[model samples]
Target: MAKELLKGNEAIAEAAIRSGLEAYFGYPITPQTELLEWLSRRMPELGRTFLQAESELAAINMVYGAACTGARVMTSSSSPGISLMMEGISYIAGTEIPVVLVDVMRGGPGLGNIAPAQGDYNQIVHGGGHGDFHPIVLAPASVQESIDLTVEAFDLADKYRAIVVVLIDGSIGQMMEPAELPPMQPIQKRNQEWAVTGAKDRERRILSSIYIDPEDEEVINFRLLERWNEIEANELRYKEYFMEDAELVVIGFGTAGRVALSAVRAARSEGIPVGLLRPITVSPFPYARIKEQTELACGMLVVEMNSGQMLQDVLAAVGGKIPVEFYGRMGGVVPLPDEILAEIRRLCYEPVAPSANPRISWMNRMNITKN
Candidate 1:
């Protein structure tokens, strides 16, 4: 297929369609409204199910119901909208149904602006839902990656009967880029043995998240943990840039990571031995890679659009073996490449002992007095 200039939200929507998405249920929210808008028109033309629910809560439950039928189902929303779906998400996780979710994150703990932000990292990566289940989270930095990961989300969701989340910030969702989408795939009839299809000649299959017996619930929890262990083992994905002989490493995801790549390149031009590690699978984080970098790299920098959410993960991976620094612009403030470049320059030339609290140091630098 020839490459075309495509908007990220629309590209992802079409990619899901081409991937044989059978049903979509979502309420329109900023940064991701285009996705639902595109599907509103395309899904009907393709004779697939498309619904605009009353709200995010309704939308997620609709997705949950559709997924139980073993259909390729999806939903998209922004940060606050995602929060509203947490209970439904937990239910889907407990039921062990396959569902794909796209989160075009914007700012805030509340009704923040529609600007791009990575604040949803902890909420989505760690569980916001009340449960003992973990969802597979994929972060994409570019529009092209957004399209590709949308397709991958469905496959992964089905393979393990798990929830797969494509977590991108608002910037990627609103950006435009030249990308090639996969050819349309024919929708395959689902024959999942565990699916709650009609029991015409065979015994009925019951799928529910509720287990009244405590021991039965414990067994379910164990099953979830074992599956999570397998996912962590096989699905960890990341991309390394200029790391062959890197002495300083930068870690970020989505737009922060993409911007950091530019900074790393700038630092390299100035003869700095710096590299970048962008995690594609955030849930199954690339801890092993970070651990390896600790052996070779003198120091590490973590950049994010939130207040050091991923920083904690990197610190755990480093295990205090090397100095770890953090830089962030929260509340929808996207950091510029030059800003990250400056941090890299400091890491390379003006080395300091790792602070007891990196966020405190960062706040001091930013002149924000923590009250």
Candidate 2:
């Protein structure tokens, strides 16, 4: 493996290339526009079909059509653009076609802004469209993870006959870092026993989630639930540091998770007893492992770029066995190590609990502004 300096978006594009993605379809959106442009320029050199979709909706729908033909296809967009693709994503989900969608998130609710944000966590993990299905959402914190997960998403999606999403943000997508490229592999379509390439050559294969009978609907749900259970059992991935015998544990994901690790080191140096839990698989959520860790820790502090999405998961995981607290900066505000360390100090030194009188003093505001 040879290391090369690469931006996160470039790494993802290269990974798709090396993974032998059959086609690329996407519209330009901030934080991820370079991703599509990279494919547009590079795919042709390798004689792969790359389409600059007129809109996000069209891009995702084109992915849907290509996926029906059993092609390894992908599309990318930011938050608002992803919202536009939700209906089509629903269609893709119902059709149960394998595709990869990359979300380079930006501040949202509207035109928002071109900046790093993880506010899309809930929407991506919980199924944005109207349906009872979940997309396998992968959150990558670094260039290397982005490359590895991008390639892995295809394999996972193909195996499950479902969609795999690489949920990243501007910071990771745009940030330059060192990555080692994996050797390219030929992407021949596998399992004609299930693919719909040509019926004349084999039995007809239907790629869809539409079930009419009530019993069959239940059967489909059961099959999907079983697959999800397997996902929970084996696909969950996370990282922990300095957690043994710690009094307080900091939980976060993506770039926020990286900064929280630094804060854990700083708090440890200050004798504030701290550790970190960085979640890599946001979908499987690593709830059981988080619950086990909460058994020993005094408290769990969830740090996130969003208001408190991951915090709720932490609370549910711990089930009040330990005190759960939250600290966040929303709408693209990425918290720093010092800011996270301050929260750790409060959790370590202060006796604030869910029952403790909430300290809503004006001093807190002054301190935050001053800091």
Give the TM-score (vs. native) of candidate 2. Answer: 0.94
lDDT (Cα, tens digit) per residue for candidate 1, span 66-101: 999999999999999999999999999999999999
After superposition on all CA atoms, how large is the RMSD of candidate 2?
2.3
Report residue 41 deviation for candidate 1 (angstroms). Answer: 0.4
- Evaluated with lDDT, which candidate comes out highest? 1
List TM-score per model, in order.
0.98, 0.94
In model 1, what is the error at residue 251, expressed in angstroms?
Answer: 0.4
lDDT of 2 by residue, 261-348 (tens): 8899999999887888889889989889888987688888888888677777887788878877777776887889998888888888
